[model samples]
Target: MPLPSIDWTAQQKAARQRSIAGGGKPGLTRMEQLAGKSGREVLEGMMSGELPYPPMNETMNMWLLGVDIGRAIFQGIPLPQHYNPLGTVHGGWFATLLDSALGCAVQSTLPAGRSYTTAELHVNIVRPASHRTGPLRAIGTVIHGGRQLATAEARVEDEKGQLYAHATATCFVFDVPMA
Candidate 1:
């Protein structure tokens, strides 16, 4: 299979920015020493060029935990209000985040004229996600590329690299002939 050409749409990025910015701020902060780039710029670099990490990488979420990437790092924190009536973080939260990460990883490496859908998904929830588990990170990678079907692997782990959950999926590719 040919290497994927990445293109993160402007509209998709704008929406993310709006979510982050929330309501309009009263004003701007003093240059903030290190002026940050818009999510779109960072994504553009990834799409047309390169980023320091994989797509769907939300290291920026670290602000919530007051941590930095690769330093005293915890894992992605459990989402708030993500609890089920059973008094535990809902499995759906894990599934949603995993699905997002998995799908985005594929999208990040996909070529135009082609699209993908989950043909099969198997998530093994070894441990429950706890709001107190510090932070968590879900990493996804491709395991196989086929003419009509592709396979991928994903893991949701805590800061200490302890696996909380693991999943493997088969993605159906369509609308484009294999090149």
Candidate 2:
């Protein structure tokens, strides 16, 4: 089956507009400001510019587009700088996109005072992409959310929904340390 056409450029522009409208900027959120907020609340804060977005997103040319209780969506633009010697987008780029989505999906499932770190990640690239690939999206969804651990999976797909890569991640859930 064929996926529906998507205007990726327009989608990207719209998302950026919303981010700016909400005063979203790349930086760090102070621990104090995160106190007692559920994972979903923290993510929502970032989306709404009440908290800082991660600097890594800027570095990777990716942005978190949306989030829900156990899901996260991110978009990335592949540029020449992200290519490997073979003249294709590097696997690391795919891994980073998948990792970000997977981590965020798990994070979105946590309760207040809880956090997670990626304990394991595995990526499988099924196709190649280049700067010309336009915008690609990594959609992550939590498979299991537990007190001590969580698992999630993600897929990197083009605007037309062609799968480029897929990955799974396991995260260790823990309590945020007291200040």
Candidate 3:
């Protein structure tokens, strides 16, 4: 069955407005400012504009929406630039969205002075997406957070809750180096 129509332009506009209201802009937080802040706190800072959002988000047409203790939510707008030669959204786009959500989900669980990097990632694309797919959301939740490793899973769905892709990631957790 066809998914219900969505006013994606309005949705994107609303999201951008919220980001702007919160002080969000594409940039990176300085390590000095990040020192002693927990992962969740850092994410909160980015959301509220106390810290700069990642520049990659602008390039990919995606941004973080929210974060919790061990979960992260992100939204993306697929455009022609993201399409593969086959005339649909490229799998790399799906993987990038999922990776961001999954990595942030794991990061959300880390304590101050700790960080993580994805050691392995597995993505499963269940449905094809295109520019017409509208705004899709990726919700990521931590499966496990340990001293040395963390695992997370994420799913990408449209506004109507139709799944397009799902992914899992294992991240290597380590202490952040102080300079």
Candidate 4:
């Protein structure tokens, strides 16, 4: 049987709260600050269609579901240790964010019952993000969706909108059996 699902937002929130409560050191981590933002929740809600998207004139910090390239966006926060010794955001962070955004971009295209898994991923880390770079945004989209594979492209930008990384992922779809 399929296992019980974990609520992503709730789980992340509780974990952060616990870490803060434990308190070996003080101050909210960068990821924590970004994840706790109301804009972040808005993005999640928009993806689930719980919230209606804004007008074209509306400028939102959060990612909106099914947005065109102009306004499309998705954000992610990694653990405190997600950075390199130089205190720069690691490539792995970009990998995960690109994976999620690319997969979710495909997910937005899927019909009910049919899901997808990443078949292959390729990323190029052009630069790195310092603490000053703040959180990160991985914007992704389906370049092409074929019968067997869906192609996606993603760009990872720091808070300043600097292009830190870019990637392409191919997702294989699971074609559900018809009743």
Candidate 5:
């Protein structure tokens, strides 16, 4: 198998451009502002593109599609780009999607200045996925949220609702100082 072609010049330029652009919503500088809004509001901003979607979403071809207080849903397609050496969608891609959903589900429950990071993640792949799986959805819901920690669960499934993978995550909650 040959390595994918690369245009280092173009790739470098694109990387530079992305950095200067600031990955999230423009002109929103205060992390406290996020803590001030309900989880729904923040998720809404991401979905509406009022907030710039994370660059990773573009790289993975996945994006936040829906959210509520303690739940989030993401959609993606399994493309050749995600293929593993075995020619199936890599387990890491499934884990990434589930992690995003799980983390965001906890994020949706946070207050403006508050944030959480994945302290631990556990994923179980029940069925292999590939480009042939068509489009898929990852749905996450918060199982518990406390002052210092949050736990969420998520599952990845095809359009017809066949389960491919599922996961749970623990996040360490913290407050960021406002400037």
Candidate 6:
């Protein structure tokens, strides 16, 4: 069989468009735009390309696929580069996906000028993921959102709904200065 191919052309085009001359704004500048909007609005903006996608997501071949108040979903593919010494998808990939989803779920509950950082994360790898796993999704939902803290959980599953990993996280919420 022919080796599978991954496409980077579209992502490259988007990267170029995110350059300063291409109308890309810096993170702080963009956050200013989110100052008064809801977290859901900010996340939607990111998905729609109105805001810059997080560099980490791009680097890891993950993207924000969907979001709503107190919920978020991300999609990623396990690639050859993600393999560990044991020849399976690295645990870090699972952790990253789970953390991202959980944090974003909390983020989706924030008001403008507010942000959050993962204070704690607990992950359980239920199964191994390989490149053949095809597309995987990490779905997150917020369990609690207090003034200074938020808790959320997430699961990484394949298209057929087989769970690969699950995680829970607590995030510290804070306000950032408006642009």
Q: Give the winner by TM-score.
A: 2
- lDDT (Cα, tens digit) per residue for candidate 4, span 1-179: 11124443343344334433544122222332223224334334344434443231122122322334212345555544667777776777678767767877776666544557899999998986654555566778789877688899989875456888899898898765544
Q: Itemize residue pairs with steric clashes in candidate 5.
A: 25-52, 34-112, 35-111, 35-112, 35-113, 36-112
Kindly report which residue pairs in candidate 4 clash with one another. none
Q: What is the C-alpha RMSD of each candidate to the true structure, in Å?
A: 12.5, 2.8, 3.9, 13.6, 9.4, 6.2
Clashes of each: 4, 0, 0, 0, 6, 0
After superposing candidate 2, which stretches have Cα over 4 Å from the reference?
Answer: 1-6
Residue 92 error, candidate 1, Å: 1.0
Per-residue lDDT over 1-179 for candidate 1, one digit per residue giving the tens place of the 0 to 100 score? 21123322233344334434553222221222113433223323333323332333352232111111111111245645667887777777676556645644554455445556888888888888667775565666667756677777778876466888877778887664334
lDDT preference between candidates 4 and 5, better one: 5
TM-score of 4: 0.58
Tens-place lDDT digits, model 6, residues 1-179: 11124343343334335443434443533545676777888777766667766767656777766688888877788788888999999999999989989998999999877888999999999999888887777889999999999999999987567999999999999987644
Report the poorest 10 consecutive residues by lDDT, candidate 2: 1-10
Query: Sort by lDDT, best first: what order?
Result: 2, 3, 6, 5, 4, 1
lDDT of 1: 0.50
| Runs off by more than 4 Å, candidate 3 | 1-12
Error of 1 at 90 (Å): 1.0
Residue lDDT tens for model 5, 52-119: 56767767767676678889877677789999999998988998999999998998898776778999
Compared to the true structure, candidate 1 yields what TM-score? 0.57
Whole-model Cα lDDT per candidate? 0.50, 0.87, 0.87, 0.57, 0.76, 0.78
Q: TM-score of every model?
A: 0.57, 0.92, 0.90, 0.58, 0.80, 0.82
Q: Write the per-residue lDDT of candidate 2 for residues 1-179, one digit (tens) a residue.
A: 12235576666666666766888888888889899899989888887777888887777788777888899988899889899999999999999999999999998988889999999999999999998999999999999999899999999998677999999999999999988
